[model samples]
Target: MPTLSMLYNTAIASAFVKILLFPCYRSTDFEVHRNWLAITHSLPLKEWYTSHISEWTLDYPPFFAWLEFTLSWIARLLGFDKAMLDPYNLNYVSTSTIVFQRSSVIVLELVLLYALCAYVRSMPARDQPNAILAAIDIFLSPALLIIDHIHFQYNGFLFGILMWSLVLAQKRETLLKSAALFAALLCFKHIYLYVAPAYFVFLLRTYCLSPSGYRIQFKNSIKLGATVIGIFLLAFGPWIYMGQMPQVFQRLFPFSRGLCHAYWAPNFWAMYAFADRVATFFLPRFGYSLPDAVNSALNGPTRGLVRDTVFTVLPNITPRLTFLITLFFQSLVLIKLFFRPTWRNFVGAVTLCGWLSYLFGWHVHEKAILIVIMPFGLLSLKDRRYLEAFRPLAVAGCISLFPLLFTPAEAPIKYLYTGLWVAILLKFNRAAPVPLKRQFLLTRVNLSYMAGFIPLLIYNGIVHRIVFGDRLEFLPLMLLSAYAAWGIFWSCISLIWLYFTDLD
Candidate 1:
């Protein structure tokens, strides 16, 4: 296990790297948060959600807006540039603005660092060393590097809260606090609704249900329900009092968005979209001309545009259908956790629930892969099989994030840094046992899947540009997304099978 001083020194090094990356590529998310600061600082409390001077309106839940509102005071009082708080200052990014915004992510990520330490400390003595490994890997996660620092979101801060909730759920005395923290997390960003079913089932089965028999713990159930409702009320109370609840809900859940983002998230839909493309266009080349509507194949879903998905050869996917599919798969994990709500099983259910949602959720952002990768880290240390499951996901999830840092200056950092992290994880993945033949077969298949990345990366970074230039600009993204989807799918299946059959 790493000594406390080692963890502190590593964190300092991570922060230094983040400071250097301040001048690196940042996404539109920079302006989004800057706009939030301005809106929260310059506007009245009543108009927080109503302001629309900038296109990046206040869409996050009330707690996050409140967080911004609180930070706005610090920005104003601390002598940072006050112009950054102008609601109409569209795309205003001065050096001070950049410093404040970037610095805020680095500092708030201390929350993530804290939560990881706490979770590691809370682990049983036998699991302490392995838990420390999870903490370190998650802290140094390539996904966080590309997505949070370069892409510029508060994901580290939010996921920190998630880790805290998970830690609390481990003990019976703190289960209510766990549920409350999770409820607050949802209000902070409802995307966490991905694992809501798991929490609900785990809390219901383990906490609210009598431990010995099937009798209901009505008093405990009411207490749990009230705690969750109270947290939501605290978050939404002001908006509800102003009678703008519908407005808040609309901004929070914009179903008007497309089935996928401009860049396909590396999940099931990426592969699904690819298959439709092949069936639509490739069939005609083999003299399988059937439908002229296939003429629209050129403008199909994988065009890398952010618009509602339209399928040419397959059934169109609606948000309703996606929700049902996500819920169905997540229900399987939840059912297992409902029966066996051990700490181990709960952690597995959380990871699988997030995986199912990311794979099947409508309009999933590629960054949501962190949802799978972070939670799965806890389970990976159990044995060789668990580490085997994590290996492909860690690799796929890491490489899928490479596209996020597409600038030449950031490419070396993502590639080398993520490469190092994966190597350390592979070393740690050692020491677990399996049958010789099964281990051999697994290693061979994993190596082959990983080997494909060489040509894929080469083609994406070099050959595609040399051959097609800007013509098929979206091809690289499609290839990366589809490839990662296969590996994540494999990991999810293996983990799910382990969850069902593995002894607690």
Candidate 2:
């Protein structure tokens, strides 16, 4: 039976979305999303599968292109007009027509959302069915759906396939089905490559590791591998046979050198970017043109400052360098977990992998944080050992999301929804085992999280004054990093106290 909290959460989510439905459903990124659809639908068949297009739409995985192609054909059959959507002639397309076409995305997203909820509820829940539903509601709240659905991104589809894969894995129903689900996720988004390792780990543990001995179950492994390969071939085989593999890969994973996102998200990258900009201002001698006097001062007595500047700028390393560094750390973490093999450690390792990738990888979008945070948040809430680790993370995650409200220019509605969701999560957590007891530093941590937002507010106030100023956009991100930094600090202290308590 569902608890009152569960019922209330469901009702609230429904009411909230319905009330704000029109406002929340506006297409922010749908322009780009629609272009992707156009690329697939408007092009010739060969060109549709070929990825050497000069646009944002084709620069995605082959499976995504295939999906767009399929949808575009359906749209054409429905008599959708292309002249109306021509970016060159926005006036040509009536707003109502465009809205009608984009409505398909909302419809598809709703289906995916339903699948996600179903998968979450299907998870093994001994007695806390309400707790499980509440926990899922907390993660997949209106705010999240608004981001994925209204803002218009394929994250809904990717996350849907992911949750489906996880549910399949838990059931241990069919190895082929699980592999196919995972393979489909990979097709949906290349970022999901990080989670592929976890699938392997699971397969090794569940299927490859036989009870009789250390010998591998070659048959089951072969079956799983075959299913995964079959899905890949079905998605990519046609283009591969046509000798367009290079073009496909190039489009999907273009690793060009670029600056951090115009708007940074709170992570190591943004924090480093902030510190680097400051260091660059103070350091000298590398610029093309400067007065000799100023150059001399920078070159001569401030040599020590230059060295210090290097220290400050180190964290703001290039995306590729940061990618390698993050990869190294996550790999080490994954190895540690693979040996020890606890659910907490495994999820943490996977989260670290996905988080580090998003923070440091090239062409990252802020919203991608959901890829890691949502699943990890759900896992952390469900397990006892992960409770404290995730609580601070949850707080930090909420703080990180503040920039979204500002970016969308959402009014009080955004804040209200954010606050309500956070309160709901906290309330649900309070009822679970290892509830959030008001302990030492709890208030301080929350205060610190709130305090981190100040730099962003100040940065925003002064943004227009600077010449090359959009650095302010990074301020909120830096605050989020500070939140995470503080969370880690407090977590370490908590661990030390727990150790002593155990000894006592």
Candidate 3:
């Protein structure tokens, strides 16, 4: 097993790399956090959710607002301009501001580092290979580097909390603590709601009710219910007392956004949109003249607007339909957990639930792919089949995030770092004695698909500009989304098949 000193050194090395990226390209999320710092610092609790000074309002839960409020004080003490704290100071940027915000991300990632060490320590010696590989994979994940370090967000911190919850939930004695931690996580960021059903079903089956039989334990059920309710109350109690529940909820779940983001997430919806585009293009050759309304609806997805998408070639997908599809897939996994109620099964279900939501949920951001990928690290450790599924999924998912850091300076860094990480993953898998079969066809197919990214990246980054340029501005994004969606969609099906046939 790797020693504590080795793990600590690994963390130090990773932190050093993150520090070097302090001045890399940052997305508007940098401004969004700064705006959040200002709002949380200057405004009252009641105004936290209601303030619309910037388009990026306080959409995260109240606990996160409180966290930002706490950080603002430290930022102020570090010589950050107080004027930047003003709610109306939109697009404010300064060196001190950049240092404070970027440093905060680096500092908070320590939580993830700590949680990873704890997880590695908790695993048995026989499982050490998988655990160590998972830790390294997550630490060097291109998605984390892109989304958190460059694109700028607090996902690492939030996912750290999630890791602790998952680790705690594995043991029967710590189930209640896990529940409380998960409740707190949801209060911190409601995006974790994607995996809530797995947590709920697992806790209900294994803790509140009998695992082997269908008898409810009234006392345990009440205790679990009260514990969850109490955490939520602590998070929202102040707002509730001020009668701001509706406003808080509106900020939390804004159905007004759209069916797809400006860049469609690599998901089922992306594939659906792609198919619609193909049908619209070729159907005219078959002498089918669609109405103007139908053509207009079909054109919306191609334009990549941030409003509700209409399908000209197919039925328009409503938020309700997306919700139902998500629920149906989630239920399939949750039902499996209800019967099995084992720790491994619970982890698998959590991974599946995340995959379902990311694939079919309405308005999913590409960054949300982390929800599926992170838990998948856990599942991959237990089975080679999961590792197989993860290979393609991770490759495609990381590549799909390339568009986020499109600047010339950061482009080489993203690719080189990702290549290094993939090399490490491959080396570790080769060294591990997992008895993985060497399937020539499967290996060739995966390699071929992964290699396709070379051409895809070239076209999107260079060839597109040389060819159509601004005339076909959305073409690259559309192609990237559709291509990545196919890979992820196939991986999802492969995992589902493994769950039914191989998982016990």
Give me candidate 1's TM-score against the actual structure.
0.96
**Model 2 agreement with the true structure over 1-504: per-residue lDDT tens digits:** 554355446645654564444445345365555666666666665676453343344666677877877776776677777553343332233554455445654555454455545555665566356445544554455446556544556565566666655555544555457678778878777788866666676567666766444578898878877888888898888888888888778767665534344345445555565455445555554663333434433432123221211223333245557668767756665565455444444445556667666655665555666666556654554534345554555555554555555544564555566556656655555544563543434644554654565565454434443643653343444445545545533543443333223211
TM-score of each: 0.96, 0.76, 0.96
For model 2, what is the alpha-carbon lDDT of residue 396? 55
Q: Lowest-scoring 10 consecutive residues by lDDT in candidate 2?
A: 301-310
RMSD of each predicted structure? 1.9, 6.5, 1.9
> Residue pairs in steric clash, candidate 2?
84-93, 266-477
- Residue-wise C-alpha lDDT for candidate 1, range 1-504, written one tens digit per residue: 555556667789999999999998888889999999989888988888887788899999999998898888998998999999998889988989889888999999998888888887897787777777778888899899888898899889999999889988988999998999899989889889888888999999988999886689999999999999999999999988999999999999899988878788889998998888768867768887657544455556667777788878778899999999998888878877887889889989999999999999999999899999888887777777888888899899989989878889988898889879877887885444443334322866886887788799999999999999889788899889999999999988888878888767
Shift of residue 41 alpha carbon in model 2, Å: 1.7
Cα-based lDDT at residue 162, candidate 2: 68
Query: For candidate 3, what is the total of clashing residue pairs?
Result: 0
Q: Scored by CA lDDT, what does every candidate get?
A: 0.86, 0.55, 0.85
Candidate 3 residue-wise lDDT, 1-504, digit = tens: 545566677778888888888889889999888999999999887889888889989889989998999899998887787877987889998877888888898889888878777787778887876787788778678999999988999889998888888888878889999999899999999999999999999999989887668899998899999999999999999999999999999889889988888899999999998888788778878998867645565457778778878776777899999999999989988888888887878877888999999999999999999998888877665655567778789989998998899889998899999988777765555534553653312655766787898899889888999998688788899999999998899888878877765546
Better of 1 and 2 by lDDT: 1
What local lDDT does model 1 show for residue 322? 93
Ten consecutive residues with minimal summed lDDT in candidate 3? 432-441
**List of clashing residue pairs for candidate 3:** none
Better of 1 and 3 by lDDT: 1
In model 1, which runs have C-alpha deviations exceeding 4 angstroms?
290-295, 431-441
